[model samples]
Target: MKIEILLDIKNRLGEGPLWDAESERLYWIDSLGCVAYRCTHDGREIRAWDLPDAIGSMAIRKDGNGAVVALRRGFHFLDFRTGDVDLIVDPEPDKPNNRLNDGKVDRRGRFIAGSMDTSEEGKNSGLYRLDPDLTLHKLDDGIIVSNGPCWSPDSKTFYFTDSWSGEIWAYDYDLETGNVSNRRTFTRLDTSTGGAADGSTVDAEGFVWNAQVYDGKLIRYAPDGTVDRVINMPVKKITSVMFGGPNLDVLYVTSMAIRHLPRFPHDPVERGALFAVRDLGVRGVPESRFGA
Candidate 1:
């Protein structure tokens, strides 16, 4: 694929990229930076804000003027016009060691995200679902590090990954009632070929494109969990990726820089940088809104 540096922010933990079809802009977060940013696809007209906590993932509001944010504390409303934040709830207020991670808006508009223990003890992290009505439900737990919650093109299948483990799970998703069942191991990585799976996205053709945490490669998996394609990256700490661009044909990837500073001091081209790959010619559906 044709890859090029799109944004050179070089964040410590860059993840959770989303495309706003209404505003025609792309949004992402720098976890360690505790910041969320919005910028054009061409890497111009940038605007950013520092949140009170590390922002893991965010979904654009249906109203088009705000975002549903998965902050360290919990879910909140971030108003872009006024810089206002309204707390919805802190699902695990007592668990100071855990924080929200990768998140997505379901087909029905509920926000689904997962949390992981910062201590890496892997004791009490879990997957959570927040209904548009503001009710929080624990879907699963005992996770080490949670990442990636993308749906199939038809929105009938849900895919998730626990970065600590080298496996991805799939579920039969019910869009009407916001229910998931039939959990099965969709695929397990060898870890020798790639590191853990960090983030992923589904395409128009139902293929799952996942990023390798420390292996510097992005892989495309067919619906049956067979590997189809691989795109090698220039950085080892690739965190997350999303399909953006006006036509959703450009694949935007986020990487980590601080962890690789000691190994790639001379990395002037692509270490921890936001990259764009445009040769695949695949398109993605618009990100679902925060609420119905």
Candidate 2:
């Protein structure tokens, strides 16, 4: 399969790659640069928005108007038509040292997001859930850097990663109560080698795909936590991965130059651009909408 750059916008720290199947477009955020982009899958018809604050991730709304985004301070509803940001509750009003990070919509349409400690020295951040009715819930605590959060095919299990701990954990998820418990380790990585789990997604076949940032590795883990496949990325900071394209066979991988190998074919230009792996031979389930 040929890997190609999908966009040359070059983000400072490109994370959150999401495909809005309804519009046939891809949405992503440059976490450190305070910007977000909407583009054609082929890198054409691009539109960039300069956000007032840095955004970690966003969840597409069921109506397709815009998204519910996680910002430096809190979550807000970004209206594409008027460029307005409607305030949502800030779960951590007193914790100024924490910043929002990776997030995704749940099967029930609640926006589940997590925060990270700015200094990376304190475990002050945790996972949060933003209900469609505008209520907020703290799902977990004692986390330094929260990354991946995707559900099992049956919606009975949830997988989350603490990037700093280099471990991915699983929880028995309850849809009716929006609760997760029975936390246990699903997989672990050696951050001692400077690699940790980042953003992740699930395929229709029930496999979990995660990008190991700062280590240039993509691992496909079986439901029981066995390594199924390993993909060597061109850049070290492979922040996130998601399945897109018409048939959902294209794997859109986001990268950053925050860390890198000694030399690669595309050095500086690969700094924070999005890349695509075509005909990956797998398809992903459609993303759940924010207020579905």
Candidate 3:
């Protein structure tokens, strides 16, 4: 199926794009602009919320009510109806150079996110999990550009990426204990290519769909570590991807137009647009909003 350009956000740095099944809306973040956007299927109405800091990613609650957001300072609960934000946790209070990057909620409704250096040049970041009880645990360390915290459909395997390392790693996940082990290289990007792996999501078949930043493409990988398919995009930097729509057939991808090259020309229109491709038939899990 062909991918369609749903929204032209002209975002300077578009990062996370998620689909809320209950509301039938698409939510995404513009990391540099510190803005969150919501769009419907018909594309008639668009709503946006301004964040105090860069918002890396967000997930809707299990009850289909609100959302939980990963911010530069920490995580927070966002009331969709009123736009009220409440702090959840601050992972790196001492390191002002780092901030939350990409994140997703697991099958158990736990928010797992990672951190990255603000300059995008150091390995001082790590992956973290926020449990239901609000306790924060450091899952993995020594990550530079922390991306993808996606799990398999059965929740037995986890896939993560460290962009600077140009590699995507998979681990045997223990859902009961929230422990990850058996780390092994799943895929490696050719540095000669324009980009590396960014955010990713798993399909029902356990295949991983990863957004290749600076490459302007989304790659679908088979469990055996073979490149199954590549969906090309109009923009150069593809930050993230998620399955949305009621049937989960729509594949939504977020792209950024940042000038990663030392002497690259800028295209005003393609820099931060939200693009969508249809007929993939992949549905995504909802974001978990906290409840009393």
lDDT of 3 by residue, 1-292 (tens): 8766787767778878887766788888888788888888645489888888888888776665567788999988878788888998899998899999898877676788999987777889989988878889999988888998788888888999988888899999887878889999998876686578898988878788999877777889998778998877877777898887777767788877677455434554766778778876555554434332
- RMSD of candidate 1 to the truth, in angstroms, is 2.2
lDDT of 3: 0.80
Against the reference, the lDDT scores of all candidates come to 0.86, 0.86, 0.80
Q: Which tens-of-lDDT digit does each residue in 1-292 have in candidate 2?
A: 6788888667778989999998999999888888888888888888777788888899998899888989989998888787788778788999998989899988899989999987766988989999888899999999998898999888998999888787899999999888989999998776666778999999999999999987778899999998998888777778999988778888999987554234322445576879998766889888888983
- Which should have the higher TM-score, number 1 or number 3? 1
Ten residues in sequence with the least summed lDDT for candidate 2:
258-267
- Model 2 global lDDT (CA atoms, 0 to 1): 0.86
**Candidate 3's TM-score:** 0.92
The TM-scores, one per candidate, come to 0.95, 0.95, 0.92
Alpha-carbon RMSD of each model: 2.2, 2.6, 2.1
Q: Which residue pairs in model 2 clash with each other?
A: none
Name the lDDT value of residue 169 in candidate 2.
95
For residues 166-270, what per-residue lDDT tens digits would candidate 1 score against the true structure?
Answer: 799999998887778898998988797547898899988999999987788899999999999989888777888899888999999998777633433233346
